[model samples]
Target: MAFGLVRIALECDKEEENKGVRVLLEELVWRTYCNGKKSGFATRRECEPKE
Candidate 1:
């Protein structure tokens, strides 16, 4: 069996949005871990209109 985990970090600006409430996930960074070891890293990015 294999085990995996992912940790995400979000960025928020504005006190009103941080009142112990949910906020929009505009940007974030994530790290993946497998078998108790770091595996990969990823970040949120905007895609171009023309793919």
Candidate 2:
């Protein structure tokens, strides 16, 4: 039963990966994080250097 649940979770993750859902999720996380920050400086994520 636990293995079945893990398989389902992985399948759902694969589908979302192909649909670029991670980018959307990251955008939401970045926005929420920036909004919660106390600094007034720049907070845009696109300007961040790719590591």
Candidate 3:
């Protein structure tokens, strides 16, 4: 039998000056639930040019 897998990708903006430090920043992400249970949180940010 084959199992199904789910993948998610998030894009964020690259700061002009700082690149490494931006990853540490925390943004409030909305929570998602499935079957009356918490599933995950979703957050969005600016996307980089390469991304």
Candidate 4:
């Protein structure tokens, strides 16, 4: 995720920083929660963001 974010930051235009961060966080949320649950890989609630 870190590497992917870094690549996004570097490859994306400066004007699109907000969009990049939004997309990255959205994807992380899906992977951390939805996908995890679907695969039966529990995402610890304590480690998740309150929001």
After TM-score superposition, what is the CA distance of residue 7 in candidate 3 from its true location, in Å? 15
> In model 4, where do residues sit more than 4 Å from their true spots?
1-21, 25-28, 31-37, 40-51
TM-score of each: 0.35, 0.14, 0.32, 0.13
Best by TM-score: 1
Q: Write the per-residue lDDT of candidate 2 for residues 1-51, one digit (tens) a residue.
A: 333321111111233455654543343222222333443232335555764
- What is the per-residue lDDT of model 4 for residues 1-51, given as tens digits with 9 covering 90 to 100? 333321111122233655544443223222222322333222224455766
Residues 1-51 of candidate 1 have per-residue lDDT tens digits of 866665544333444644665445543665656555667776768888996
Looking at model 4, which ten-residue stretch has the lowest summed lDDT? 4-13
Between candidates 2 and 4, the one scoring higher on TM-score is 2
lDDT (CA) per prediction: 0.57, 0.32, 0.56, 0.30
Task: Give candidate 3 regions above 4 Å deviation.
Answer: 1-28
Q: Quick one: ranking by TM-score, best first?
A: 1, 3, 2, 4
The 10 consecutive residues of candidate 2 with the worst lDDT sum are 4-13
In angstroms, give how far residue 9 of model 3 lies from its true place: 16
lDDT of 4 at 15: 32
